[model samples]
Target: MVKIKANYVLAALWITLLCSCQKRSPEIPEIRQVDVLIVGGGASGTMAAIQAARMGSSVLVAEETPWLGGMLTAAGVSAIDGNYKLQSGLWEEFRKNLYNHYGGPEGVKTGWVSNVLFEPEVGDSILKYMAGLEDGIELMLNSTLGHIEKTQKGWIADIAYQTDTIRVETQVVIDGTELGDVAALVGIPYEIGMDSRHLSNEKIAPETANDIVQDLTYVAILKDYGKGTDMTITKPEGYDPSPFYCTCAGRCNQDSIGRKLWDCEHMMGYGRLPGDKYMINWPIFGNDFYLNVIEMAPHERKQAYEQAKWYTMCYVYYLQDALGFRHLGIADDVFPTADGLPFIPYHRESRRIDGIVRFDLNDLARPFAQTNALYRTGVAVGDYPVDHHHAAYPQSEALPDLHFYPVPSYALPLGTLIPKSVSNFIVAEKSISVTNLVNGTTRLQPVCLLIGQAAGALAALAVDEGVSPADVPVRKVQQALLDSKAYILPYLDVSPTSSSFSAIQKTGATGILRGEGKNIGWENQTLFYPDSLVSKSALQTGLQDIAAGLVITSKKETLTVNEALKVIYDLMKLRPGDTHFSSREAMDEKAKEIWKNHMDTLMDPEVSITRAMFSVLLGELIDPFSNWPVDHHGTYRSGIN
Candidate 1:
């Protein structure tokens, strides 16, 4: 009996040891090394990742939210604000995908405020699909940046991804966060809220600066469920309908006569999305909430966002109970949250970094006439008017009338993406170096996309060339963007589809040929009249900067083919080449040979040369832009200066 009991004890101890060995230990955090580390998976961050990956660099995107499209998708601001006609780069690709999904452009034009409107989930899915197609991108959803340390070789960042912390070592770090959090973490200098007139040098700017940013909105997607469905949500805490009474049925000063200018139906139809839904992001006495949570802690920000969400819920209640639209409720199938609200609030402004160059109102109003020629270093373009939302502020009435400041379509300089103090860093989204006034326009959807794309290209080029972002040649970055079908010059007339697009772009960058910019109502323009005849004085003005001794002997106003050949001969003298013709006849003979080899049509020496023809010839022959390198301030470093 004692021997059997001892055997039983031995068997029990062995079983216990086996059970202890089978138990799992705590998981260790992973350490990932990548060429480019994008901090946020927002609009610009996602574009930056895709662009960097497409440029043959391994990229990792850390997005706090599960979705990618920040304002366009997660924030539920589905209606595109601008860039309806200026679809370039990834923005054009994303828009085309949207058109494909919705059947056509006509299918998504369900809103009166914008030409394009779709469900937020659809935008998120499209972005995910676009990002997924790139093999070089690795996306970490539900990830938040923890600690960032700049090393001698690159940057090391600790990102809280899902249930574990991930250490990422990258050569380039892109701050694509909605609020520029990564830049702030690295102790980079940035500006918040308004800039004084003395600082910004805008005639309309206020004398004193303040911490007053644009009102952010927590957009909610409401769907129409039938008249008798009773889709109205439960009354929110501290719900009051009195504040929003004036939103739909009230007499305002804008109306010359004392009359109700707006109705509930018209207000709802303003943001009506496809498939019988509403965006619920109205501005005037609507859901635009006043809060600056940029400096708040994570928990503090969440608490603040809850207040904004409740305020939006209050407005929704007002829409249903007071306005008699009881059938419209929060769209249950839109978001992954327990509540039907968007994943994040629509932030209209962010901490603007102090970059190598500061893009201001003057840059937009008169791009070509700037002191530094900032237009020559453009990487992204925007045409939206300076639209600000400050109705929620008490001193909003004292602010300058931004609507009076009309600006032509302008290109954002590449220097705006490179921080002056930080190395190997690029800022995208709304955090670029632009004045508060310019941010109102650059903060739009399409411009942010292009800006993100440019940031990606700059980061990728810096990694591939083994140089800092600031050290990368501005022309090289611009050329890469052009190759990606992006606009370095905001020329409305000449598009990426044009055969002479690259040539015109290169020539325009060199200031050898300039476009005329105009501000017509809401549609700003920079027209490059490709078919117009090249004038002698215009050519002389353009060539004076590159070719110092070139003189136009032709007495006619418009330059002919013979005169153009002589000018090309003079230009050839400045650049080193074997085809340095001794006389106009010899130059013409060489030009004919070159034209036959390059261009399709026969060379005619009698016909007047058009702007397009001259640009193509200059691109093929001299390629002057390659020789001239512009500095951070857009000043030419070598020839022109």
Candidate 2:
């Protein structure tokens, strides 16, 4: 009888243990639905989330690192590069915040390498503050994405955060991850490293394609502790000072009157940040390490990153031991890492997606002459020249001299952000579809921020309209960017603060009054010449492209107010078949009715119309961009006229 009771007790104990194990198996992670799920909260990803949230889309940003900014903060490249005169949208907002934090523009200009420089921590705090203001954004730091699949409605992804797995159902996905990891995870076709001349048709590209990416820098931020401080760290492994001997040797600057400013002080001041901090990211012979970790597994990448970190530590030791700058020590309070280095490396290249349109060097060299008017669909702009760091590679000698091909300031096309096959995917970071040559300019911080803003707008519009990102109207995206004080056209003279900013942007995108671009020194310029007079031929040519079957009877060389008004009347009557305006008299009366709506001054019929006035009149009245619909390639669709 006692043996029978023992058997029953053992059976009951087994049943209880089994039930407990089943209960603790981690209940399949509750589904969290969002309108947009942005992977990687880097520079572009952060801007994308904020922009999407502002557009009324519930956004979830999954970042692998704890900090928000990628290269700008987490990677410790806090010095701003390019787009100095072309501050638009979130870039401008971020800069203004820096100015406020540091007491103005002059305060942050402690470094000679860039006009804007700050500590990485400050940049992160500002970005976090900016993101916090938006209520729709759910930023998950130290989070990673896993197991994403496309569904008929949208996408479903599993996000791992703090020992918990959260399933996300998102309408649109933005690949803002460093090295384009999210796109790679989703099986998006992408190209890495150098492209052959035949592939890109770029004059500067090498004849043969190779998997040679730019050298990544493991940045170290050093602070001036005190005059007699001995903050020198122990010597790192492989501490040969031969590779760094030429680091202080100045580089040849073609823009600086062909002078090479060689000095140790100049090298130290290159990335000098505010508050007596130094950004040790010297590219020449410094800490730029060559490693393509894009395709590596997580553990493999972690191991490779350790080597890069050691290489940077060697450089830091060289500065202290050899150069005798012992007062400057690693900024311990900057990052949370144990080694006092950045959370990530400053990746200069990524997996360039095979997007709907592939931007090349030819597009930047000649924007208006392209077979497809890609410039018309521009969503982001960059002015930085084509810069590549290949000193570490032996094969770099076979490549063409990139500095020989000077490109003007250019805008990035909207199609470059949308993958050709992905339904609702958008690429925001350095991974956007561009030739290896063009990625040099687009990969900068300011351009990446603007690209992120554009990506957010595209994703939000796609979710709101229940359409794919490729199907969203090009002009609608541009309009949304302009509404947010961003630039679609790279007009150096006309800033976002101008009252006629939207007017000029709309007209410029329509290819009506084109801006002239110039590559003078490092500062590339595209001037609208708002004060210049609008010639009759230019006006007629622009009108013909949009308003088909319209006749202009103007004989004068330049267009006056009366002549411009006549052309507008003719275009109105031809297209949309405006029955409200029977003749020039009726059209003029209607124009007068809406004159106060667009202009601040009274009507002056005899005054010659300037380019600015003409753009304003046509952009407000005709609205050619609205009627002209464009495809993903920026080519006009048929049957629109």
Candidate 3:
């Protein structure tokens, strides 16, 4: 972690206060600064701050809202992605907290893909606790970013309030703001609306592209316990139930953003409270704050946002009165302010980075074996489909079904997180480079948190290693990820000495580093799809299937340690740039040394012969891979050992 000057820190926080002092309020607190200035305390921004602080750096978060945890907390939505499997680290911790409160693990049973429904308050407490642990993480809420400029030493973030303006000159500036507003303010190249071309060749992209973008939503909390309460809520300014809808509230369309508008389907939804003993997520007010509010000027945006809040409050009144329910309240305890107005105004599109590598929809559906190039630099796996949400269908339409293209859990490149012009800055939110269609799926809360963790980890690596983020070696990045228990590279639990890997040699190879939809049968059999589940059965089956596929030249009396080493060396050799061995010559050298050492140990009977010993050695010797290989045409091509 780099040491920041005290004066520079004061400049960053005060810069915002300074900007605010000119207009409305008179008295405001002085500003404070830290090493890294995060503009948004949403999902990604929070994760970035925590990661940086964990690595021993000074970090500060400037949130426009009072509370953190953007969508999960402020939005009052209980559902996470349908594909939040392989839960670990920050995400896993979030679940643990919910389970602690709910008294049982939530969600329908689906092996690892089980959904974890939680109350908004629990989510808020958990996220705040996660970042609040570090003394170095300073939170400056109700502060707004006014501008960002690159100085010789590093970068400075200008934040403002009604009475004061603060400037934070830090080594790194992360644009975790939901709208990617910070990136725009910093002069970063970004795409605003839908992509001009169907880069992903997605079925949902319009035949004729336009500047139209997806609408936002303002989710409200509701409850019903058969108690007594007044709940007749007033509708929005233009809301009409008789002719309800312009856009599909419950569904999504892939193509034609210009044809979409907010509908009534999702205007108010119901779900089980933490215990599944009550009702929740009944959006009776604020038809859609995140959607229409983007078109407003700053003050107008604030007004629209507040109006949505009031509308949502009125909606709760409507639901209770209409349904004749007794037990229901606004749940204002969650947001603390805005009268239970969600802490976040669900932002869909933000300033996406124009990086060296771009992931389009076409690449996702391509045969994993054919487009293996996509995995060469994979840092994380995404088994979800290209989820796209558009406007224009009511609750009666099949709008949510258009986004059915399943993509593999492929590697995300380090390059994609780095901004082109801003060297120290990284865009961890949906702001990372991708087509709008791709952004639709990736913008989910879970994805943002995980990607933010990865980005934060990389930023930590850069700071710790005294190198630019671009120069952090790939292998170092992978190791740091592994150390943090993040799953950028999938791991197989096998034992040559134990029963886990009955046939050690065959079970240890990686045909596709991808999970779920890794271009199934396009080259090899790597099953992948949106509805894919990561079950214990799948893990066992994949291990056996790939092991059986290995070509054994000769059947000897028994598999020796020497022979196993050769096989291990060859499997890792499919790609030259990987960790174990980069070249055939190097592989042979390491194999010789390993074989000799094993032979020497075997020659001595005093050496341990227990299965436990063999298993430990096998696990240690197994090649750990972070990504797969692709051929020239960018196909998921693999060569057998």
How do all models score by TM-score? 0.92, 0.92, 0.70
What is the model-wide C-alpha lDDT for candidate 1? 0.85
- The clash tally of candidate 2 reads 0
lDDT tens digits, residues 1-641, model 2? Answer: 33433443354344224322312124578578999999998999999999999999999888898778899999999999999999799999999988877778998999988999998987887787788778798777787888899999889999887667789999999998889988888889999999999978886688899889988999999999988999999988668888777676443343442324358777799999988999998876789988999999988999999988998999999889888899999998889888889999999999999999999999888987778789899999989888887766656566666652567888899999999988989998999999999988999999999999999999999989999998888888998999999999899999888878888888888887788889998888899988899887776676655665666676778888888887776666656543345677866665666566657567778878888877777766667676667766667665453
Query: What order do candidates take by lDDT, descending?
Result: 1, 2, 3
Cα RMSDs, all models = 9.8, 10.1, 9.8
Question: What TM-score does model 1 achieve against the real structure?
Answer: 0.92
Which residue runs does candidate 2 get wrong by more than 4 Å? Answer: 1-25, 250-261, 547-552, 577-582, 593-599, 638-641
Whole-model lDDT per candidate: 0.85, 0.84, 0.54
Clashes of each: 0, 0, 70
Q: How far is 419's C-alpha from truth in model 1 (Å)?
A: 0.6
Residue by residue across 215-297, what tens digits does model 3's lDDT show?
56566655433445543344446533322222234333415433433333223233444432222333222244334443356
Q: Write down the worst ten-residue block by lDDT for model 3.
A: 521-530
Clashing pairs in 2: none
The residue-level lDDT of candidate 3 at 26 comes to: 31
